[model samples]
Structures are given as structure tokens and as C-alpha cells.
Target chain A: MEAETFTLILDLMGTFAFALNGGLTAVRAARVDLVGVITLGMITAMGGGILRDMMLNVQPATFQDWRYLAVAAAGAFIAFAFSWVLHRMAIPIEILDAIGLSVFAVAGAIKAMNFGFGPVQSMILGTVTAVGGGTIRDVLILRVPSVLSEGLYAIPAFVGAALTVAALELELNGVAAAILGASVCWLIRVVGVYFKLNAPRPPRVEPGNLQG
Target chain B: MEAETFTLILDLMGTFAFALNGGLTAVRAARVDLVGVITLGMITAMGGGILRDMMLNVQPATFQDWRYLAVAAAGAFIAFAFSWVLHRMAIPIEILDAIGLSVFAVAGAIKAMNFGFGPVQSMILGTVTAVGGGTIRDVLILRVPSVLSEGLYAIPAFVGAALTVAALELELNGVAAAILGASVCWLIRVVGVYFKLNAPRPPRVEPGNLQG
Candidate 1:
């Protein structure tokens, strides 16, 4: 397949996975209706890309392509319809979430490079693309965003984005490079989840001296 | 002043107000450091406009102009330094927030109309522009967005946006029209706050039947 075609496929897959994950999370976390479920799902699936495109001053791919919306809605609907069953399969959903994060990170980095962003900016944008939707979802559900507090979420995405940027710099920009970057991200995230690891927290502060 | 110049001033004033409000909220709500305080403040000031520009497929004005960043940072720094005093002056800060909301709503509507959106789309976008930043800030601070739950937040914005759209439709598209729209929104919000009013809530649902 052409690189564009491959990227599109990966994007769609990530969209579906994120939508499903977001919908399931809403079901577990909040007392929302179908509209809320679908809205949250679509936001989770498409919010990151929209944010990325906005920063890049380009039209959002989610708006330009109907397939992205369709897939996201379908995934959300499936989760809503089968929440009872899906809620029990937490491990699988988490793995799918990891997949979404990895693909989005790689795709975001590549797109940033295509838009002439430097390596550091590309890497940061890539991580933002990967975590933005989940952060929004967490916020809507009235929770602290996992990226700010959880272990390995943004770290894996950042690492993946950096690896993708390295591949492009080394003139190894292809399906193989994408896979390599994404696989490393996925591996790190899965391990982090399995180990229940945590990123470091700030040292304790005095009660009334919270000033930075 | 020319309408464009008037609008620019209103936009900057709104940015400053939101940054200060965001910074104050961070100090009160989260045990964050200086970086967190400033990040949240900037996000609250600029996130809405960036989202609006993204949806409109235009370059974000925040990125195009240096003044926006400078003003936002200054406001955040002020809030950080004066949190002890400002936290006690809640009513004044709230009034500033209302000003930000009103101006943003009117400006967003005007900008959307200039971009050739229809009345309904313009109105919605305008409300989004007003509430979007606050929602993002609330999410980062791990609270339900006031727009989703509080009285008269989004409603006032929606009303202002609608009035702005109406003024545009009547070819009253200038500083006067902007002021008229913003004033009505500000009045309603202030009244709502004074009365401790609430928008209608969903009817009570049975426990365990929260499916939408």
C-alpha cells in the first residue's frame, strides 16, 4: 500500500479504538445518556487531530473525511450497546487504547514533519495528538487527566514521537519505521499498565506554602 | 475606533481577564507549581480562540500575534503574585470573567459571520469561543466545567452570540452592535449571579438506570 493509504488506515483504526475506549470510560465513570456517550467518543477520537490541525493551521481531517466520523460513531454505539459486556473486558480495552496512542503519536509526528515543523515541535505535537483526546475525555468526566498524573501514558507517546522523528531524519520514513516507533510505544505502555507503575510526584510541601 | 480595532481591544481585554481568572483558580484548586499555574492560565486565555480558529480553518490569532501571549503571561503572573488578595475579592474577579465571556461571545460570532458561517453556526461557535477556554481550564483542574452545570454561563454567551448574529443580519455590524450584544450578555450573567439562579436540570433518574 502507498504510505498515505497506510497512514489513513492507521488513523481510522486509532479513531475507532479511541472512540470505543472513550465510550466505555464514559459508561464506567459517568451517568450519561446515549448522546453524551457518542459525543464523548467522537471528541476522544477526533479532538487530538483537530487540535493538531488547528496548531498547524490546516483543515481538520475529521471534518474533511466522513469515514472518520462514521467509524468513531460506530465504535461509540457499539460500546454503548454492549457496555455490560465490554466493561468486563477491561484488559482488552486498555490494549486497544494503547494502540490508539501509539498510532496517533507516530502519525502526528509524520504529519508535523510534512508541515515543515522542526523535530522538537513534531515530537511534542505527536504526543499532544496521542494524549489530547483522552485528556479531554477525562476532563468531561470530571477526573484529572491521566497524562498529567498517570505513569507512562505521555512518556510512551513522547518516546514514540521522538523515534518517528529520528526515523525521518535518518531517511527511513516508511511503513517499517512507523511500525517500529509504534511498537516501542505500545510495548512501554503495556508494560507500564501491567506493572502499575507511576511517574514521580513532587515532594511534599508544607500545608499553607503551596506557592511554586 | 474602527470596528476591527475595537474588536482587537475587546479580545485582548478578554484574554487578560481569562488568564488572571485561570491562574487564580489554579492556585485555589490544585497544588500545582509555577509552571502549572502559568500553563493553565495561558490555556484558559488562548484555548478558546485557537479552537475557534481551528474549526474555521484559519491561523490562530494567538500564534500570529505576540501581544496575546505577553498580555496573558502578565495577567497570570499578576494572579500568582496577588492570589492572597485576589482570592478574597471573588466578586470583582467574577465580574472580570463575565466581561471576558461577553466579549468573547460577541467577537466569536462576528468572526464566524465574517468567515461566511450562517447564523446558527455563528451563534454556536460564538458560545464555544466564550466557554471553551474555561471548560479546558476546569478540566485541567479536575472539576466539572461550570458551563455544563452552573447557571447562566453558556446561556448568556449563547444569547450574546445570537444577538450578534442578529445584528449582523440587520447590517448593524460595527462597534455599537458588538457593544449591544455584549451588554445584554453581561447583564444577564450578572443578574443570574446575583440571583443565584440555575438553568433547568434533568429530571431525577432512578438509581442504576443512568443509561441515556
Candidate 2:
């Protein structure tokens, strides 16, 4: 029970952070007004969980817990109220993106596993959790999804989730499993960025490039 | 075979018209430019079928019929080129909206029934089909869904589809059925607009109501 409460707090914090990042992105990209900023922020934080819950035929996690709304609203409020100062700050956007990625991966995998998903399904859930919100945000804002177009995005979460589910089957407790899971995901992601571990690309097949 | 070809042509025309409508809405909203118009147009035309297929665990209908893409692209092109003239024309938007609604409703119901869904499922499909494209477009544009919030949108389609399916059961043929289905939907929609039939508003919980 205590662990669940702690996890929920972490989840809410992650949501707030994600919302802040979304608001900042919206302002930078499309110059959204305050209402638009809040809407985008809320969507970026809660969109994936909503998708997961709807697909799984469960009540949406955000709707079930008022804390989710509070987190998102608070984040949006802060971002809207302090746009000038925050915009001038040297805060790295990538850090917020990383935090969003890690928290969502953990939350999504846990939710899926709780619903009795197998390791493969759990991994997919984790990937969805990590990237789904941003995907929705981009589509709504009429931008190509960053996940599909750039970066080594989904693979790390997939690997981390598979490891977490695997460790659980081997009888590890929750905290240790989370630390291990997050470590695997975070290490690979951080290293991949620094070292530029390129995702494989299928070269474009132009008509002139076709061989007989 | 000839009848199938005819239906196919009409379907493409209907798709083109709706795609244009979607593009015009975005342009009116002025959130994006050429790219935005095309993207929204494609989504509006194909979004319903995409949602249905995703829910049914099938590959999307647009993937099966590349003509959908052709029609969408053409519609977007026409809208982009002629938007200024169209916007200036004295023609009412309601006529085009009603036509789009009816066509989408019939298409959705037919597709669902053909896919072996029962009546209730078909009804659900009909409702989604008629308004799903518009709903998604509005969401992307960050406007309240016109269907869900200010109009007698979904209900008219629902009624029209029920009549069409019932007619089908009674051995009504293609031309007669299509006419009846479309007319029924359009008449209801026009009536709704003229007389303002809509769902009751949520209570006045919004702030600043007292200021007025």
C-alpha cells in the first residue's frame, strides 16, 4: 500500500514534468495561447495512458485518479504563468524528454503487467507509454511524429520492459526490479545519445534505383 | 459489375467533398498552411475507417484501397487552389456538411455490416463513421468537436443509418436505398439546424458566468 502511494506520487510528478515540457514545445513550435498551451500540455502528459486504458477496456488512469488532472493542470498553470522566465532559462529540453520517457516506460509496463500481459505485450505497452503522448501531440499540431521520424526512441523502452517483466518472473521484488529496469533503459538511452547509436534505416528505393 | 463501378465513383466523389470540407475548416482556423490542409484532409477522409480497423484489429481500409489516397490528395489540391473563391461564394456551408454526413453514415454502416457486425455495432459504426472524421479534425485543431458539442450531428446519422439498414433487410436496392438514406439524414440535419435540436448543455459550472 505504501509502495503504491509512493509510486503514484512519482507518477504524478512525471506527469507534471511531461506537461511542462509539452507546453514549452507548443509555445516554441506553434505559438499556442494560454488555453492552447494547457490543452497541449494535458494531452502530452495523459494521452498515452488514456489510449492504453481505452484499449485495455479499463477506466482511464487519469480519470480514476484526480491527482493526474491536478498534476497536469498545475504544470500547465506554471508554464503559462512563467513563460518569459522559463523561456530565458538554460534548461535543456532533452532532460525533460528523458524524464518523460523513463517515467512513462515504468508506469506503462507496470500497468500492463498488472493487467496480466505477457512480457511481449508489456514491452509494447511500455513503448506506447513512453512515446504515445508525444505522438498524439505532434499529430494534432500537424507535425510528423518525432518517434517515427527521428532518434532511437522506442527500442530502449522495449528492451527495458522486457527485462523488467523477465526479472519479475525470476522472483525479484518491485523496487529492485524497477531500479534494474530503469537502469537498463536509462543507461542504453543516455549512452546511445552520447555515442550516437544509430537506428538502422531502410534506404529509400527510388524507381531509378531498382535493379532488373 | 457496372453498379459496383458506379458506387465506387460516387464514394470517391463523396470522399473528395469531405476532404475539401476538412481542409477548409483548418484554413478557416488558420493554424497551418498547405501541409496542414493536406494532412487534415487525409485524416478526415480516412480517419473513421482507420479507427474502425484499428479497433477491429484489421489493417486499415485505406491500405486496401489506394483510391482513397488519390481522392484525398485531389481534394486537398482543389481546396488549396480554390479556397479563396470557395470561401467567398454565397453558398451555405450547411448543404455541404449535410451531404458529407449522410454519405459517411451510409458508408460506415455498410462497412460494419459487411464485416459481420450486428445491428448495435453497426449503429455505433454509423455514428462514428459520420462524425469520426470531423471529430478527429477538430481535436487536431483544438476546437470543441462540433458533433459532440453544439449540434444535432450524431443523432441524425444514427437515425438515417437505422432506416437504411432496415430498408436493406426489406430488399431495397442500391439507388433507392442510397437516396432514401441520404435524404433522411440531410432533412433531419437541416431541420436540426433550422430549429436547433441539440443535447442539453452541461450546467453553468464555468467561472465568470456571474460577470455577465
Model 2 chain B, poorest ten-residue lDDT window?
B198-207
Q: Estimated TM-score per prediction? A: 0.61, 0.54
- Tens digit of per-residue lDDT, candidate 1, span A10-129: 788899999999998898899999999999998999999877887998878889889999999999999899999998898988998899999999999888888877787788679879
**Residues A54-158, candidate 2, lDDT per residue (tens digit)?**
566664567445578778878876766666567765245555556667767877887898998887888788889877887887766667877786677777777
What is the two-chain DockQ of model 2? Answer: 0.04
Candidate 1 residues B7-108, lDDT tens each? 788789899999999988877787655545666788899888878987888867676576888889898878777787788888988898899999999989
- Per-residue lDDT of model 2, residues B1-212, tens digit only: 68688667767866787788888888888668889999888888778767656544467777798899999888877777788887875246567767778877877777767776666556556766777787798878887556644667877888878877777768888567766887899899888888877644322223586566
CA error at residue B31 for candidate 2, angstroms: 18
DockQ, each predicted model: 0.18, 0.04
